[model samples]
Target: MEPNNEQAQGLYRLCYRLTNVIYPGWQYRPIQLVRIDERTGNVYVLAGESDFEIKPTGGYEP
Candidate 1:
């Protein structure tokens, strides 16, 4: 499924923040949007050279 503008923006923001927190100082190259949980409204972004599933907690809940 294609993400809308807002969703895409939100996901990008989330990805940026997650990258800093979860993989600090690492050169992260986002590969693709792997998945977006409908229940949780959580976006899964696959970053190159890492196997970390960064889930943003707090403020966002769905």
Candidate 2:
């Protein structure tokens, strides 16, 4: 797999774990990579209705 894809999957796992904590009673659907902005090194993910933007600096922009 591509390095970016691996990174995205790792981030996706983090996002999923976070959602489970925030919403314990919810059922999970698949997480998806909505987009990747290489110039800014930003990864966008969709987890159910929640969205996340992961920056290269190591933080989430909800």
Candidate 3:
């Protein structure tokens, strides 16, 4: 799917503010470019060794 700049930026802001563990460099941890599922509106982010799946409704699914 084509990457959405606005979507990723918004998600990054939300995640960083909500978790404080996802940010620029995460202050030391690794931060990778996020991937989004255009079909399901699911966002995937990898930080260090952690993986997150953010739902469209601003929810996290396990």
- TM-score of every prediction relative to native: 0.39, 0.51, 0.51
lDDT tens per residue, model 3, 8-61: 565766556545654544454455657887887778877666776776655554
Can you write out model 2's per-residue Cα lDDT over 25-49, one digit (the tens) per residue?
Answer: 6566556656677677777777667
Model 3: lDDT of residue 53: 76
Give candidate 2 regions above 4 Å deviation.
1-13, 16-29
Residue 4's lDDT in candidate 3: 52
Comparing 1 and 2 on TM-score, the stronger one: 2
Give one digit per residue, the lDDT tens place, for model 1 in 1-62: 45556666666665675456466664546555467666655555656654333244422222
After best superposition, candidate 1 residue 12: deviation in angstroms? 0.3
- Clashes (N, CA, C under 3 Å) per candidate: 0, 0, 0
How much lDDT does candidate 2 score?
Answer: 0.64
> What residue pairs are clashing in model 1?
none
lDDT of 3 at 25: 44
Best by lDDT: 2
State each model's CA lDDT, in order: 0.53, 0.64, 0.62
